[model samples]
Target: MRRGDEFAAAIRRGNRAGRPTLVAHLQVREDVAEPPLVGFVVSRAVGGAVVRNRVKRRLRHLMRDRLHRLPRGSLLVVRANPPAASARSEHLAAELDVALDRLLRRRGPDHQARTDGRV
Candidate 1:
Protein backbone atom coordinates (compact mmCIF):
# COMPACT_ATOMS: atom_id res chain seq x y z
CA MET A 1 0.00 0.00 0.00
CA ARG A 2 3.01 2.26 0.31
CA ARG A 3 3.91 4.40 -2.67
CA GLY A 4 6.78 6.51 -4.06
CA ASP A 5 10.29 6.77 -2.57
CA GLU A 6 9.47 5.17 0.76
CA PHE A 7 8.16 2.05 -0.90
CA ALA A 8 11.20 1.81 -3.14
CA ALA A 9 13.51 2.12 -0.16
CA ALA A 10 11.80 -0.72 1.65
CA ILE A 11 12.24 -3.01 -1.36
CA ARG A 12 15.87 -2.02 -1.68
CA ARG A 13 16.52 -2.95 1.93
CA GLY A 14 15.37 -6.52 1.18
CA ASN A 15 15.84 -7.76 4.72
CA ARG A 16 13.24 -10.47 4.88
CA ALA A 17 12.29 -10.71 8.55
CA GLY A 18 9.91 -13.57 7.79
CA ARG A 19 10.31 -16.83 5.93
CA PRO A 20 10.51 -16.55 2.14
CA THR A 21 8.37 -18.77 -0.07
CA LEU A 22 8.26 -20.07 -3.65
CA VAL A 23 4.99 -18.21 -4.32
CA ALA A 24 6.34 -14.87 -3.17
CA HIS A 25 9.47 -13.16 -1.81
CA LEU A 26 8.76 -11.20 1.37
CA GLN A 27 10.86 -8.44 2.82
CA VAL A 28 9.74 -7.21 6.22
CA ARG A 29 11.29 -4.19 7.88
CA GLU A 30 10.41 -2.64 11.23
CA ASP A 31 12.53 0.48 10.84
CA VAL A 32 9.59 2.57 9.70
CA ALA A 33 7.61 4.48 12.28
CA GLU A 34 4.37 4.62 10.32
CA PRO A 35 1.63 2.05 9.94
CA PRO A 36 2.37 -1.16 8.07
CA LEU A 37 2.39 -0.89 4.27
CA VAL A 38 2.82 -3.40 1.46
CA GLY A 39 4.33 -3.26 -1.99
CA PHE A 40 4.13 -5.62 -4.93
CA VAL A 41 6.79 -6.34 -7.53
CA VAL A 42 5.76 -8.30 -10.60
CA SER A 43 8.48 -8.04 -13.18
CA ARG A 44 8.31 -8.47 -16.94
CA ALA A 45 10.21 -11.69 -16.49
CA VAL A 46 7.04 -13.06 -14.97
CA GLY A 47 4.76 -12.22 -17.92
CA GLY A 48 3.22 -9.48 -20.04
CA ALA A 49 1.71 -6.38 -18.52
CA VAL A 50 -1.74 -7.88 -18.21
CA VAL A 51 -0.53 -10.98 -16.47
CA ARG A 52 1.70 -9.00 -14.19
CA ASN A 53 -1.16 -6.70 -13.25
CA ARG A 54 -3.36 -9.67 -12.56
CA VAL A 55 -0.78 -11.09 -10.23
CA LYS A 56 -0.50 -7.80 -8.40
CA ARG A 57 -4.27 -7.56 -8.08
CA ARG A 58 -4.49 -11.02 -6.57
CA LEU A 59 -1.65 -10.32 -4.18
CA ARG A 60 -3.27 -7.10 -3.04
CA HIS A 61 -6.51 -8.87 -2.29
CA LEU A 62 -4.72 -11.59 -0.36
CA MET A 63 -2.78 -9.00 1.61
CA ARG A 64 -5.93 -7.09 2.53
CA ASP A 65 -7.51 -10.27 3.83
CA ARG A 66 -4.44 -11.23 5.88
CA LEU A 67 -3.44 -7.78 7.11
CA HIS A 68 -4.78 -8.25 10.64
CA ARG A 69 -2.56 -11.31 11.17
CA LEU A 70 0.53 -9.29 10.20
CA PRO A 71 2.52 -7.20 12.62
CA ARG A 72 2.08 -3.49 12.95
CA GLY A 73 4.49 -0.74 11.76
CA SER A 74 6.38 -2.85 9.24
CA LEU A 75 6.84 -2.94 5.49
CA LEU A 76 6.19 -6.05 3.41
CA VAL A 77 7.18 -6.48 -0.19
CA VAL A 78 5.69 -9.42 -2.06
CA ARG A 79 7.52 -10.31 -5.25
CA ALA A 80 5.78 -12.62 -7.64
CA ASN A 81 7.32 -15.51 -9.54
CA PRO A 82 6.68 -16.35 -13.17
CA PRO A 83 4.33 -19.18 -12.33
CA ALA A 84 2.31 -16.82 -10.18
CA ALA A 85 1.51 -14.61 -13.16
CA SER A 86 -1.16 -17.02 -14.30
CA ALA A 87 -2.08 -18.77 -11.10
CA ARG A 88 -5.76 -19.19 -10.27
CA SER A 89 -7.32 -17.16 -7.50
CA GLU A 90 -7.93 -20.12 -5.22
CA HIS A 91 -4.41 -21.45 -5.69
CA LEU A 92 -2.91 -18.04 -5.14
CA ALA A 93 -5.03 -17.53 -2.05
CA ALA A 94 -3.78 -20.79 -0.55
CA GLU A 95 -0.18 -19.93 -1.34
CA LEU A 96 -0.66 -16.47 0.15
CA ASP A 97 -2.03 -17.99 3.34
CA VAL A 98 1.00 -20.25 3.63
CA ALA A 99 3.46 -17.44 2.97
CA LEU A 100 1.65 -15.11 5.37
CA ASP A 101 1.63 -17.65 8.17
CA ARG A 102 5.35 -18.21 7.66
CA LEU A 103 5.97 -14.51 7.82
CA LEU A 104 3.75 -14.04 10.88
CA ARG A 105 5.59 -16.78 12.71
CA ARG A 106 8.70 -14.65 12.62
CA ARG A 107 6.99 -12.33 15.10
CA GLY A 108 7.61 -15.08 17.65
CA PRO A 109 5.93 -15.86 20.97
CA ASP A 110 4.13 -12.57 21.21
CA HIS A 111 1.85 -13.56 18.37
CA GLN A 112 1.20 -16.92 19.98
CA ALA A 113 0.15 -15.17 23.16
CA ARG A 114 -2.05 -12.82 21.15
CA THR A 115 -3.67 -15.82 19.48
CA ASP A 116 -4.46 -17.30 22.87
CA GLY A 117 -5.75 -13.92 24.11
CA ARG A 118 -3.13 -13.89 26.84
CA VAL A 119 -1.03 -10.99 25.58
Candidate 2:
Protein backbone atom coordinates (compact mmCIF):
# COMPACT_ATOMS: atom_id res chain seq x y z
CA MET A 1 0.00 0.00 0.00
CA ARG A 2 3.02 2.28 0.17
CA ARG A 3 3.43 2.29 -3.58
CA GLY A 4 1.49 4.68 -5.80
CA ASP A 5 0.39 1.84 -8.03
CA GLU A 6 -1.10 -0.03 -5.09
CA PHE A 7 -3.23 2.92 -4.09
CA ALA A 8 -4.18 3.56 -7.68
CA ALA A 9 -5.19 -0.06 -8.18
CA ALA A 10 -7.41 -0.01 -5.11
CA ILE A 11 -8.94 3.29 -6.09
CA ARG A 12 -9.56 2.07 -9.58
CA ARG A 13 -10.91 -1.37 -8.63
CA GLY A 14 -12.49 -0.77 -5.20
CA ASN A 15 -15.90 0.21 -3.97
CA ARG A 16 -15.99 3.61 -2.29
CA ALA A 17 -18.12 5.56 0.19
CA GLY A 18 -17.79 9.26 0.76
CA ARG A 19 -18.65 11.25 3.85
CA PRO A 20 -18.32 14.87 4.83
CA THR A 21 -15.05 14.20 6.60
CA LEU A 22 -13.47 11.45 4.51
CA VAL A 23 -13.81 8.98 1.67
CA ALA A 24 -12.94 5.30 2.00
CA HIS A 25 -12.13 2.87 -0.80
CA LEU A 26 -12.01 -0.89 -0.22
CA GLN A 27 -10.79 -3.55 -2.64
CA VAL A 28 -10.79 -7.20 -1.63
CA ARG A 29 -8.15 -9.42 -3.20
CA GLU A 30 -8.07 -13.13 -2.70
CA ASP A 31 -4.56 -13.27 -4.00
CA VAL A 32 -3.27 -11.26 -1.09
CA ALA A 33 -2.46 -12.85 2.25
CA GLU A 34 -4.18 -12.28 5.54
CA PRO A 35 -3.77 -9.02 7.48
CA PRO A 36 -5.15 -6.46 5.04
CA LEU A 37 -3.07 -3.46 4.04
CA VAL A 38 -4.18 0.14 4.54
CA GLY A 39 -3.13 3.48 3.14
CA PHE A 40 -3.97 7.11 3.85
CA VAL A 41 -4.33 10.17 1.63
CA VAL A 42 -4.38 13.66 3.08
CA SER A 43 -4.13 16.33 0.46
CA ARG A 44 -3.24 20.01 0.79
CA ALA A 45 -6.87 20.84 0.39
CA VAL A 46 -7.34 19.57 3.92
CA GLY A 47 -4.59 21.68 5.50
CA GLY A 48 -0.90 22.32 6.08
CA ALA A 49 1.66 19.71 7.08
CA VAL A 50 0.87 19.93 10.80
CA VAL A 51 -2.86 19.68 10.34
CA ARG A 52 -2.60 16.95 7.75
CA ASN A 53 -0.36 14.85 9.90
CA ARG A 54 -2.71 15.25 12.83
CA VAL A 55 -5.58 14.05 10.72
CA LYS A 56 -3.57 11.14 9.41
CA ARG A 57 -2.50 10.18 12.91
CA ARG A 58 -6.02 10.19 14.18
CA LEU A 59 -7.22 8.20 11.19
CA ARG A 60 -4.41 5.69 11.57
CA HIS A 61 -5.29 5.12 15.20
CA LEU A 62 -8.94 4.67 14.43
CA MET A 63 -8.26 2.34 11.55
CA ARG A 64 -5.95 0.25 13.68
CA ASP A 65 -8.73 -0.46 16.11
CA ARG A 66 -11.11 -1.32 13.29
CA LEU A 67 -8.84 -3.20 10.94
CA HIS A 68 -10.15 -6.55 12.11
CA ARG A 69 -13.57 -5.55 10.89
CA LEU A 70 -12.36 -5.45 7.34
CA PRO A 71 -12.14 -8.55 5.20
CA ARG A 72 -8.82 -10.36 4.94
CA GLY A 73 -6.51 -9.38 2.06
CA SER A 74 -8.42 -6.16 1.43
CA LEU A 75 -6.80 -2.89 0.47
CA LEU A 76 -8.25 0.15 2.15
CA VAL A 77 -7.48 3.71 1.30
CA VAL A 78 -8.88 6.43 3.53
CA ARG A 79 -8.71 9.88 2.06
CA ALA A 80 -9.29 12.90 4.21
CA ASN A 81 -11.54 15.60 2.90
CA PRO A 82 -11.12 19.27 3.76
CA PRO A 83 -13.43 19.01 6.72
CA ALA A 84 -11.41 16.20 8.24
CA ALA A 85 -8.64 18.57 9.20
CA SER A 86 -10.90 20.11 11.84
CA ALA A 87 -13.17 17.21 12.60
CA ARG A 88 -13.08 15.47 15.97
CA SER A 89 -11.67 11.97 16.24
CA GLU A 90 -15.04 10.62 17.26
CA HIS A 91 -16.67 12.24 14.28
CA LEU A 92 -14.10 10.78 11.97
CA ALA A 93 -14.53 7.36 13.50
CA ALA A 94 -18.28 7.53 13.06
CA GLU A 95 -17.94 8.55 9.44
CA LEU A 96 -15.53 5.72 8.84
CA ASP A 97 -17.94 3.22 10.33
CA VAL A 98 -20.83 4.45 8.22
CA ALA A 99 -18.73 4.45 5.07
CA LEU A 100 -17.42 0.96 5.71
CA ASP A 101 -20.86 -0.32 6.47
CA ARG A 102 -22.21 1.08 3.24
CA LEU A 103 -19.37 -0.44 1.31
CA LEU A 104 -19.60 -3.83 3.00
CA ARG A 105 -23.35 -3.97 2.47
CA ARG A 106 -22.78 -3.88 -1.26
CA ARG A 107 -20.96 -7.20 -1.04
CA GLY A 108 -22.82 -10.45 -0.46
CA PRO A 109 -22.34 -12.77 2.54
CA ASP A 110 -19.39 -14.36 0.82
CA HIS A 111 -17.29 -11.34 1.97
CA GLN A 112 -16.21 -10.64 -1.58
CA ALA A 113 -16.69 -6.90 -1.98
CA ARG A 114 -17.70 -5.39 -5.28
CA THR A 115 -15.10 -3.59 -7.35
CA ASP A 116 -17.34 -1.49 -9.55
CA GLY A 117 -17.00 1.56 -7.25
CA ARG A 118 -20.74 1.87 -6.89
CA VAL A 119 -22.66 2.52 -3.68
Q: Which stretches of candidate 2 lie over 4 Å from their true place?
A: 112-119
Give model 1's clash tally. 1
For candidate 1, write residues 25-98 as lDDT tens digits: 34445444445677887788888988888778888887787766555555667777777866787877777777
Candidate 2's residue-wise lDDT over 1-119, tens digit each? Answer: 69898799889999999999999998888676666789999999999999999999999999888877777778899999999988888899999999988887877765644333221
Clashing pairs in 1: 1-38
Per-prediction CA RMSD (Å): 4.1, 4.8
lDDT agreement with native, every candidate = 0.63, 0.85
**Model 2 residue pairs with clashes:** none
Model 1 worst lDDT window (10 residues): 17-26
